[model samples]
Target: MVMWWLSSQPKGQRQVVVSILPSFICWHIWKARNKAVWEGISLSSGDICHGIIQDVVLAVSSEVNRWNLLPFFDQFFDRLSEPPMPLQCKIVRWRAAGTRIATLNTDGCSKGNPRASGGGGVLRDSEGRFLIGYSVCLGVSTSLLAEVLALLAGLRFCHQRGFTQVRVQSDSLVLVGILQCWFQCSWQIRREVFHIWQLAEDSGHFSHCFRETNTVADILANEGLLHPLVQMKIYNHPCMLPQLARGALRLDRSGFPSLQLLKRTPA
Candidate 1:
């Protein structure tokens, strides 16, 4: 019935308008309806019509093959143009946790940002002796997703082992910010982040660290890429890790700090 109705409509611009109209119209209508109900906004017919047409034109015009197809396209493109920002580098140092507290450092590895991902974490005492560690293959995933999953696994380990007042650290600043409620989490990893929250409750303190300081966990994350899918391998001692990872663990145990060059953002 809908196809027949669309067929009867006048074909505009190689039938592209007709092809995109049905879905776009329905979508805009649903959005308008929600705005009216939830926000208590008065939706005038003219306003709704204008919005739908503007959105459709923008959507179509932005397509690579359809660039500047509409009169307003040039205006939209001009507004979006911006100059690239400059970057400066700064040094950051990693410090060990205070005595009597456990530290959990986690890292995520991915071949591509959204492909062939894995997560790993290491738990250590205040003296930096390895208590437990884990590495799990996540198949294909985004870097953020892998990070969130690794944090989740680490938190679960702490909770199950009756470890309290733990300090959680990760190389991903975004992941730490999400835990600190400084930013919203991506929808893809919202569930895992939420689970981490539940697991941590009041006992976990989350913080961001440089990747250089998280060497062992980073190595484990790379190792995760070779593990079986969804399978988590546990390490009770650093000897269970690869040679490079074991060496890094020893450095960490010695309280040796790692330095990182980080982008210095403008105030």
Candidate 2:
């Protein structure tokens, strides 16, 4: 029934709904099923539908523009149509590390949680010169897993290259907090993060930066999705060089993504 409703929307809106709605809806259904089986709890049809609608609205709000989604939002809330919220602008240009410490920026991408995903990282010297970088395709995984994977890849690369002094930067504040001893993580996260902290702990620092400041690494993550690596295959991946060259990946005069440069590219 929801699938039929999705098909009735304009192509642009339909695509957005298709990409986000199915997994979100299915996941909730699955969770509800699990509760029914394990905990003997049941939710009414109305309750489930309302929950799904809320989830869809929040998830799409981030990626879709406000004006483009006004009608869709109206459909959900009906007679009490909520005003579209203004977009928030918080990201700043990527900054360099101090002195001789190299800064590594990392990010993750996923089509869906437990779906096609990948991780990427960019290494730069304190002088802000781009050095080696990496992007790996993980066939399936949650985004948090992908986030940890990207951090692991970057930290391992630095360790192998004998980078004695380094600093790690990420847009995910949760990941940063875990590294900074602020919060405990899942056992899986605990294990992977231990290795990274060891690698960078001696002469390193972990910090949280806005996503706008992590542009180089963000492109690297998108590159991973665009061209997933296969085992035994040596890809002459540009490290997303083509995007950087064509202004598709976009960087400022200092070769970092800036607020002024973060326009939404049309599909």
Candidate 3:
């Protein structure tokens, strides 16, 4: 139906290639809808667009032999494949449960496989105010290792500080699974993965969060790479404090949970 409507619009042949954007978007959305209804496969807009990009590329690859399609395809694919930026005014934020239980958000960053990396975590109280933040350089490793290290750092911080009740949140779904003992981990992450749950004890309840809500910690994780190879623990590092403050204020006003676990299944 979408293609039929587009065909009847008197678009030129050049427009034919560019027109794949809307047509593929609608096609993927429709495909996603049917999957949700019958196949029980859930897809986000990102997922749908990714599928569309792959399908469109495959479909257009055949046309390259007949037409000078490289330039158009390269530009279009680059624009489409770029990572989606987080919202500037995103309401999804860290919320405090009460004055007692601190909320922890952890994140990690890596340059490449077996490259320079860092892990960081932030602690906030019930009022959505920063309590503590820390960043540690991991020398060189994969991002997954850094992410696991971040969680370990957060959990260890809570335990060492004698914080009685805390909620731990991380954007790494795999890390959360390891914390829950969902499956066996590879040897590289196996040791620290066990260390996280052990350190959590009774005070910590780990949950998976979306990256949007975990922005502040992300800053610390990336910032670690720039800092001298030393761990720093403080509420507001001068360079990153302003951004964290703005993020906190937005979340506080929006009244989103300090740590919201994004659920996959329909509630």
Q: 156-186 in candidate 1: lDDT tens per residue?
A: 8778878856888898989888888889877
Highest lDDT: give the candidate number.
1
Candidate 2 residues 224-243, lDDT tens each?
77665551112233343546
State each model's C-alpha RMSD to the native: 14.3, 11.4, 14.0
Clashing pairs in 3: 94-258, 95-257, 95-258
lDDT of 3 by residue, 4-95 (tens): 43664334433455666677777888989999999998999777766775666667563333323333445664444333333233235555
Look at candidate 2 and tell me the lDDT of residue 220. 70
| Native-to-model Cα distance after best TM-score fit, residue 165 in candidate 3, in Å | 2.6
Going through the candidates in order, what is the number of backbone clashes in each? 0, 0, 3
In candidate 1, the residue pairs with backbone N, CA or C atoms under 3 Å apart (3 or more residues apart, or in different chains) clash, namely: none
TM-score of each: 0.62, 0.59, 0.58
lDDT of 3 at 29: 89
Model 2 Cα displacement at 96 (Å)?
Answer: 1.1
List the global CA lDDT of all models. 0.75, 0.68, 0.69
- What's model 2's lDDT at 4? 59
Comparing 1 with 2 on lDDT, the higher-scoring candidate is: 1
Ten contiguous residues with the weakest lDDT in model 3: 82-91
In terms of TM-score, which candidate is strongest?
1
